[model samples]
Target chain A: MSEINSSKTVSIISRQAPYGSNRAHQSLDIALAAAVFEQAVNYIFMGDGVYQLLGNQNATSIQSKTLVNALETLDLYGIESIFIDSQSLRERNLTPKDLALNASIVSRGEIAKIVRASDSVFNL
Target chain B: MSTLHTVSKAPSFRLLETCLSIIQAGDAVLFIEDGVYHCQQSTELLRNSEVKFYCLREDLIARGLIDRKLDTIETVNTQGFVDLCVQHDGIVNWF
Candidate 1:
């Protein structure tokens, strides 16, 4: 997959809340897959997607897989370009301490640029 | 790179609000389905000059918002919607 010097940049914008639907999980999988292939991946959490990063998300009671467990493998997969929308966090009254992962808090304007720069974008 | 964002929900859901936050200058937003309701509101995004605003003509007519829509909003038909998509680099749909 890394035969070429330059790989296409892919941006995965996950905007759905965890536990409610499969979108959040699917987006994460896509990001990891892109990273595995040596593609430049940008994982952006916006709108309700930011909720997927909240700490203490235990889904055992709901009989579902814990998202945090999968999130823990992101570093191992080399997908480090994680971004959280600042406006979404402020609107939800949440901060970095409330989340389980370390991500760059970026303004929406900056996010727009990220989407524009990406060779391909997947909005889930 | 300019983007064409499409909002399909009403203002009450805040989808448009979130979408507006990410819009940049030279970008365009198209209101479709229930999103036409946004045209009737007095939201500040409608007054924004940096980005352009467009709404589906059929959706607005279906919702009886023809006379109520803001003059700042440009009404477009299905063909125009496809044209907008082709004119932009990307399209993000806000449900």
Candidate 2:
């Protein structure tokens, strides 16, 4: 059982905004925590979660830490596999260029394939 | 085959109702996280169903609901939680 969970691919689906709420941060934290355990972790940004990737975020005005800055720490945590939903980006009128981070834009079908392949999926 | 439905919210019983209607008898319903709070009151959802109901032992303890009247709800530990998931064919997390 430990072997299955240890070798299992986990996909963390983020569906909320980055700031003003704990959901998105908690999702990222869980991914980071799982990665530390040497588990395979993949991140999927959809819906309002795409906002976390937006560049030039200045949360100082609101006395909050910029979510984009926190997201930049993912690479250092060894979590490189990241994806953004194409339809969600279109709906939000955002392009890859608007994002501070580099990630693949995936179709909904592709997202489903990732979920199906994962041994466990954590949705936020 | 049975499916383990993990509920994580208090007012999210709408999905539970839908799940109960579709699930066959002898299937189990294990409530965890904040959903364990719902075990306090006997709702229509709990009264009419023949499905076995359960709650996370640790969660109930954490919430200070230990020794409370939880109807027919049984408590299971994390290991038991995993076992229940393994016993079931699928898992539907309703949060």
Candidate 3:
């Protein structure tokens, strides 16, 4: 068994679209909680999750809180190290310029490596 | 190695099964998000597993299934959820 350590790394992987649903938001809430607790937290956006980072989101049309607005609060909460899958963005015809917030773009292989390094991972 | 498996969707069972196959005893499986619905179904597969099973209390409440009786499954709140992550050495997400 691996020896337990005082510091923990938690990774939150967002795979749902922004708005029109509560899954992605709830996931962010947990991520924020872990960050506030002073834990090492990382957020990864993959699959349809890349859409959550798209810029200029206005959820008023759908009667939902904009996802980008929620994500903007991450840095303030000490939850840095946000990443998005490059392939996901490419598949959706989106680029980093389309994202409202700044985040590193990573390949699937890189994402796998990040997951391997994390002590705990939450998918939503 | 101690692996913490978190499942949040019923469709994720395929991935969860794959994870369970690789994980031995002494590991834990936590069901959260919409994954809490999986706990409601009683099946031979679940009955046979030695892995520790857990459900998120807040998720169950949100789904209006909090009052339902469950067998062989432990319910945990957000704090307990954080504790679980701390207790396990690794985490696998099945969405």
Candidate 4:
């Protein structure tokens, strides 16, 4: 990469559920890695992706590490900027009260702004 | 003004059928990712309808179904896929 000196802002949009496939996990890993590399990584949960933040997820029942638990470790990774699509939560009949973590609840316009501000965007 | 419906999931996901419902008669469909599996069972459906069906060639080969007859369905490269998207007026990425 030519601009190796500059740390770019990378945005990841997870539009899938956390439990079904490894897409959610892989997406998270990318964000964590980017953050570790000192990139300004912004996470936006949209559509089915918003389900990732549901409280009290029990992965032990499925014999897997709870993604919700892994999500808790984001703070240790230095990922403090998280945004959730307010409209998506509304469409899913969920409220911010139901979320496992505290994040900025943004509108569609704000979501657009977040994407626009980033140098790169990823989706899973 | 035709729609290019891009499907990334297999029929087992029920996304192919859902994508079909929204596609008009003159629209086209481009199968990518696991959607290439639907191409195996979609030949008959495409031949009888006005809709044109296509799948990514690399994905077909990756799935080890390159020799599959394909019949009325066309196999295209990544560039060809971009051309198809450009030719269409709209695109629907069905999950």
lDDT of 1 by residue, A1-124 (tens): 3476679999999999998999999998899989988999999998889999999989999999999779867989999999999988998999999999998999988998898888788888
Model 1 lDDT, full chain set? 0.89
Q: Report the lDDT tens digits of candidate 3 across residue range B1-95.
A: 56678888773445455345435567788889988887777655466466898999999999887877377889999999999988987878786
Binned by DockQ into CAPRI classes (incorrect, acceptable, medium, high), candidate 1 is acceptable
The alpha-carbon deviation from the true structure for residue A16 of candidate 4, after best TM-score superposition, in angstroms, is: 1.0
Q: In DockQ terms, which candidate is top?
A: 1
The Cα error of candidate 3 at residue A46, in Å, is: 0.4
Task: For each candidate, give its TM-score against the true structure.
Answer: 0.88, 0.59, 0.60, 0.60
Runs of candidate 3 exceeding 4 Å displacement:
A1-5, B1-89
Residue by residue across A1-124, what tens digits does model 3's lDDT show? 4744466888888878876578799889889888877889889887778888887889889887887898987899888799988877898999898988888888766776677677777877
Model 2 chain A: ten consecutive residues of lowest lDDT? A1-10
Off by over 4 Å in 4: A1-4, B1-95
For residues A1-100, write the lDDT of model 4, one tens digit per residue: 5555778888887878976888889889999999988999998887789999999999889888899888877889989889998978998999989999
Q: Residue B40 deviation, candidate 1, in Å?
A: 2.2
* lDDT-best of 1 and 3: 1
Best by lDDT: 1
- Interface DockQ of each model: 0.49, 0.06, 0.21, 0.06
* lDDT of candidate 2 over B16-92, digit per residue (tens): 66445445555687888887886787788887566788889888888888777465788899999999999876565
| Tens-digit lDDT track of model 4 for B1-95 | 56677889877776665455435667788889998987776544456477888999999999987887367679999999999988875565666
Residue pairs with backbone overlap in model 4? none
- Evaluated on CA atoms against the true complex, candidate 1 attains a DockQ of 0.49
What fnat does each of the candidate structures reach? Answer: 0.48, 0.00, 0.44, 0.00
What tens digits encode model 1's per-residue C-alpha lDDT throughout B27-85? 89999999999999777768888889999999999999999998889999999999999
